[model samples]
Target: MTADIAADILVIGAGIAGASLAAELAPHARVVLIEAEDMPGYHSTGRSAAFWHETLGGPLVQPLTRASYPVLEAGGFLKPRASLEVAEINGLPLLDKLASEFAGTGVGLARLDHDGIRQWVPRARPILVGGMLESTGADIDVAGLHGSVLAAFRRAGGMLETGRRIDRVERIDGVWHVQAGDWHTSAPIIVNAAGAWADGLAAMAGAKPLGIQPMRRTIAQVRVTTDDVPDHLPLVIDIAGSYYFRPEGPNRLWLCPHDETPVEAGDAAPEEIDVAIAIDRFETVTDWKVAAVERKWAGLRSFAPDRLPVYGFDPVVDGFFWFAGQGGIGIQTAPAAAMLGAALLLGQPMPDAVAAIDPAPYAPDRFVALAQR
Candidate 1:
C-alpha cells in the first residue's frame, strides 16, 4: 500500500505452506494468495491425519519439526499422543536401525522390549520382538493450524483468491502474468505452493519440473467390536511400515494399511481394496475386530525425488519460487518452514527459530545439479 515502495507477490496455493509464508511476508509486501479450490485448505490441508513427531519426516526434516514445536504448542494446536513403532521377531533389526538412525539428533527414542511395548499396546500380537517409542510425538490439529495461518494472512492485509485454477502463466516484459480465467494478476515474483499440483504449476510458468509426484494414502475410520476402546491407544505403526492405527475416539479408530500408491495429481479417493487391506492388516495385529467401517478417505502426499521438501527459488526461472513437496509433515513443520522461506525470499536473515538450519540442502537447484551430473 506504499507508493514509494511498490511491491506485489502472488502465492499460488493457500494451503499450510503458502498461507503461512504469505502471512509471514504480508506486513513487508503486498501478498495475494490464490487457491484453485473454492475454499482454502480444502484439499490436502483439510484431509491430513498428521502428527508432530521428530521421526516422521526422517532425519533431514527433524530440525524443522523440532523448532516448530514451540510455535505449534504455544498456539494449543497439539495433543499429547505418543507414537510407537513395533516389530516382529524378524523385523527387530529394522527397529534397531530406527533407533540408531536418530542416535544423536536430539530426538528422544526409547528402545522398548516386548514387555515394555506391551504396556503401551496390551493386545498387540505376540509375534512382536521389540519396538521403539517416540514419546515426544503428538497429534497435530491440522484444521486449527491451517485456519490460524489463513487468519494471520487476512489480519496482515493479504488477499485470498479462491476457486481459480491457473489457466495461463507467462513472464513478459520482466513481469509475470498469471490468470485463472477472466481475472488475472501480474507481479515480479510468483510462489508455487500448489501441493499435489506443484509440478504441473511449475510447467505452467515455464519452470523445469522437479519431479514432485503425488502419492495416494488411504485411511479408514472403523468401529471396533470391543465395547471399550481406550482413548489412550497410542498410534501404533509396524516397523516394516505395513500398517498403522490409532483411536479416533472411544470405539472408533482410524486404520491405515500404510499404502502409498503412485498416482496422477488430482482429488484422491480411497479404493475399496485398500480399505480391505487396512482391515486385514489391522486384524493381523490385534484381537479387536472392526465392527464397521464408518468412513473412508484418501489424500495425496507429494514428494520430491529425494523426498525432502523443495524450498527455494528455481535455479532457472527468474521469479518462480518453489515451496512444494512437503509430503505429510508440512503441517507439523509449517512455522519453521515459513520462517526460513520468507527470510530467503525477502533477502533477510533467518529468524532465530530457523537460523540453525542450513538452507542449501533443500534448494531447488539440487535437482538441476543432479541433472548436470
Candidate 2:
C-alpha cells in the first residue's frame, strides 16, 4: 500500500472546514484533502441539525455567520425558517437582556407578548409569557453544502484521499512529510481541520495543542400527539437553553435538551438518559405528549478556551495552520471562514466578504501570549 503523493498544500479532515477551504484554495494552489473516514462528513458535519441562526454562536461568532449568508443563499443551500426564543413570565427580564444584546448587530429581534407567543407556537403553554423572533434564521442543507464544496474542489483539480488515517507528521527541511498507514505525502503546508480530533492532529505535527475540548450534544426525532404540527413551524427554543424543538414532518419533531457534556474525541452515541431528559423537558414545555422516540443521535462540538474558532498559522510551527475549534458555528461559518483562512494562508488581503472583521482575535498568536503568561 506504499505510495508517494505531493501537493502544494495538504489539508487534514475532509469535513465542512477542509472541503470548503480546499474549494477556496484550489484555483490558486495545488491542494490535497485527506479524511480518515471512507466518506467525508462522517461525524459532526453529517450529524448537524443544520440551521443558520444569527445568534446561535453569540456575539463573537455573529460576524462570520453573517458574512457567510450571502454565499450560502446564492448556492441555494438555505431555506427560509424563522426562530422563536421563549421564556416564562418570570423569565421576561432574561429575554429582554438577550434581545438587547443583539440590538444593533443587524440580527433583528422582535419581542412577543403572551398572545404573540401563542400565535408563533400554538402548543406553547399558557405560563410562557415572553418571546423573541429572529426572522432571519434559516434551515441549512448541510449535506448539500458539503457535497457542493467537495465537488467544486475536485473539479478544480484538488486531490482527495479518504480512509487515510494520518498517524505521523514531521517537518524535514522546508517540507512536511505526512504518513497515513503505508502511504506518504509531502507538502509545503499542513492545515489542521480535523474537527473534534484537531488537537491530536496538531500534536502529531509538532504544533501547539490549542486545548480543543469536544462536547457531546444530543438530538432526537419523536412523534408528538399534537395534531397541529406544521412544516413551517419556526425553530422554537428556550432562552434558558433547556430545550428546543421544531416540526420535522406531519407528526414528527426534531428536539434536543440542549445538553453539552464533555467527552473524548471518538464516534459519539446518544445516551438513553439524555434522550429521556429531552423528552421530559419537551413535555413540560407544552401539552404535546411524546408518543414514541423514532430516532436519536449525538455529535461533538469542539471549542477553544475562549469559545471562538482558531484560524491562523502557529506562531512557533512554520508552515502549519490552525483551522480548528469552530464548535457548533463551523457549519454556518464555513464559507466565510474558508475564505478568511485561504486569504491568511496565501498572505493576501482579506476577502471582501469578511474584510470588516479583524482576524487577530482568532489567530494562533493570541494563545502564545496566554501560554507565556
Candidate 3:
C-alpha cells in the first residue's frame, strides 16, 4: 500500500546535502526527506574516507572548504590526524607546485628532508625518498556529523521516509505532486539531492536537466604489523596521487589508487585491476609489502561536467532545485553548501561570498546554455 504526505519542503535524497538542508530548513518550514535505500547515506556518504582537507582542490572550492573548517572544528567533528605527501625523487617538481599553489590556505606544509621523513615514517623507502610535506590535517568523524544533522532535523519536527523510490513527479496547481511507487507526496518546493541520480531525478520532475555523472573511486585495506610504524604518523599520499596509504587500526593501513572510473548509480564494488594497480603503486612508493590483505571496497563520486557542485533552482522549473554533483568533497563542504541550498529554496539572499561567486556557473541552466548556442 502507498501512503500520501505533504510538506513545504521535500528533499529527494538523504545524503549529506539533503540531510543537512532538511536540518537547516526544518526550523522555518515543514521539511520532508526521503531516501531510496532502506537507510540514508547508504551510497557515497557511507563510503567516504572521512578527512578534513582544505587545500586539496582548485581555487574555486577553497573558500567553501575554509568556511566549513570552523564549524567542523567547533562541533568536534575533526581529529588532528595530520597529513603528509611523499613521492619518489623525480616527483619533487609536482610536490613543489602543489605547495606553492595552496600555501595561503592554512595547510602550512614544508618540505621534509630524508632525516625528517624518517622521524615521521621510519618504514618509508629510502631509495624512493624524493621528499615529503607535513601539514596539520584533520580526520573527520563522518558518522557523527551526519547523525547530528539528522537529529537536528528530527528535533525541528522534520519528517523522513526511507525505501521510497520516486517513480514519477508532476506539477499541479503550482505545487509538486510526486509518486514513489504507490505512495504519493506533495510539496511546494522539491529538492533534488539524489547524488549520482540527480539528473534522472530532475527529469522525473519535468525540470531542465543537469549533466551530472557518477565516477567510481576504489579503496583497499592492507594488513601490516604496527611494530615498525609510528603511531603518530600522518596520512601519506603520493605526490602524483597514484596511490595513498594511511594507518587505519592498530595493525592495518588504508590504501587507494585515487582512480575515477565512470559508473551507474548504486553500490559500487572495487575492480580487481584497480586493486592490482593500487598495490603496484603503493609498493613502488613505500617499503610496505602487500603480503596480507584485510579487505577492500569502492564507492561512486558523482560529478558535473565542470567538476563543481551544482546548487540552486532550475531556471526552467519554478520550484525544482539542484543540489547534487559534489564530487568527493560533500562531507567537507556540506555546511556551506546546505546553507546556500536553503537560502535558494527560501528565496532569501545568499551570503556575500556565495553571491560573488555566481551560482549560475554551477546551475542546471548551464546545460541549456550549451544547447542554446
Candidate 4:
C-alpha cells in the first residue's frame, strides 16, 4: 500500500474533543479525523449526563466552562437547568467551604436553607440542612453539539474515517504514518484525543504516557412513583459528592451514585450493583419512590495525574500532540478547549474567547516540568 491518504494533521478519536478541534483546524489545515467506533462520540461524549455548569469543572477548568457557555448558548445547545449541591446538617460544613471557595470567581452560588432547597427541589426530606444553588447551569445538547462540529469539519473539507481504530502509529522522517483497520494514512502531525485510550495512543506514537487513568461513572434513569418527578427540579448533587440526580422527564429522573471506580479502558457497562446504589442514594434525598429503572449506562472519564486537561505538542516527540485528559467536563468545555488547542497547534494568536486563558497549566510539558522540580 502507498499509504494513499494524507493530511496536514491526523486527529485520533472523533468524540467532542477531536471533532471540535478538527472543526477548528480544518479551515486552516487539511485534517483527518479517525474514530474506533462506527460513529463519533460512541463513548464519553454520547454517554455524558450532559450538563454545562460553571462550577462543575473546578477553578482551573472554570475559565473554559465560562468561555464555552456563550458559544453553546448562542448555538442553542444549552437549555436552562440550574444545579444544587445540598448537604445534611452534618455536611453543612462542606457547603460552607464551597461558598467561601467560589467567593469571587463570578460563579453565582447562593446559600439556600432547607426551605430554599425545597423551593427548588420540591418534596425534599427535611434531613437536608442547606445547599448552594448555581442557577446559571444548563443542559448541553451533546449529540447536537457533536454533530454540528463534525458537520462543520466536513464542510471545511476534513476527512472523517469511522470504524477504524488506530492500530499502528510510526513517525518516519518528518511524517506520522498510521494504520487503522487496513486504512493507511499519513500526516505531518498526529493529535492524541483518544479519550480513555489516550495513554495507549501516546505510547504508540513514541511519546511519554501522561498517566491518563480512565475511571468508570454510572447513571440510571428511573420513573418516580410520586407526585411526578418535578420538571422544575434542578440538577441535584450531594455536597460530599456521594450522588446526583436530575429530572430527565416529567415522570423520570436520572440518578447516579457518584461513583468513580477506576478501571481499564474498554467498552464500559453499568454494573448491577451501581444501579442499585444509585436508587438507594436517590431515596435518601427525596420522597420520590422509584417505580422502575427505565435505563442505565456507564462511561469512562480519563484524567491526568493533576486532573486537568492536557493540550500541547509532545516535548520529546516532534510530531505528536496531546488533547486528552479532559475528564467529565470535556463536552462542557469543548468550544474554548478546541479554540485553545487550535491556536497552540497552529502557532496562531489565541482567539478572543480564550485569549485571557493561560494555557500553560494544561500543556503536556507540565509533567516534564514537574519531574525537573
The model with the greatest TM-score is: 4
User: Model 2, 351: alpha-carbon shift in Å?
Assistant: 1.7
For candidate 3, write residues 152-207 as lDDT tens digits: 99999999999999888888887898887788889879999999999898888887
What RMSD does each model have against the real structure?
2.4, 1.6, 2.6, 1.1
lDDT by residue (58-155, candidate 2, tens digit) is 88789999999999999999999999999987778888888778888888999998788777787778777889999889999999999999999999
* Alpha carbon deviation, residue 16, candidate 4 (Å): 0.4
lDDT of 4 by residue, 1-373 (tens): 3586989999999999999999999999999999999988988999999899788758899999999988999999999999999999889998888877777889999999999999998878998889999999999999999999999999999999999977889888899999976689999999999999999999988888999999999999998886556677899999888899999877889999998889999999999999999998889878888999999999999989999999999999997989999998999999999999999999999999999999999999999989999
- Alpha-carbon runs more than 4 Å astray in model 3: 1-3, 113-115, 127-134, 351-361, 366-373
Which candidate has the highest lDDT of all? Answer: 4
Per-model TM against the reference: 0.97, 0.97, 0.91, 0.98
Which parts of model 2 are misplaced by more than 4 Å? Answer: 1-3
Question: Candidate 1 residues 316-365, lDDT tens each?
Answer: 89989999999988999999999999999999999999999998889999
User: Which regions in candidate 4 have their CA more than 4 angstroms from the true location?
Assistant: none
lDDT for position 112 in model 1: 89
Candidate 2 lDDT score at position 184: 94
Model 2: residue 312 alpha-carbon error in angstroms: 0.4
Q: What is the C-alpha lDDT of each candidate?
A: 0.89, 0.91, 0.81, 0.92
lDDT of 2: 0.91
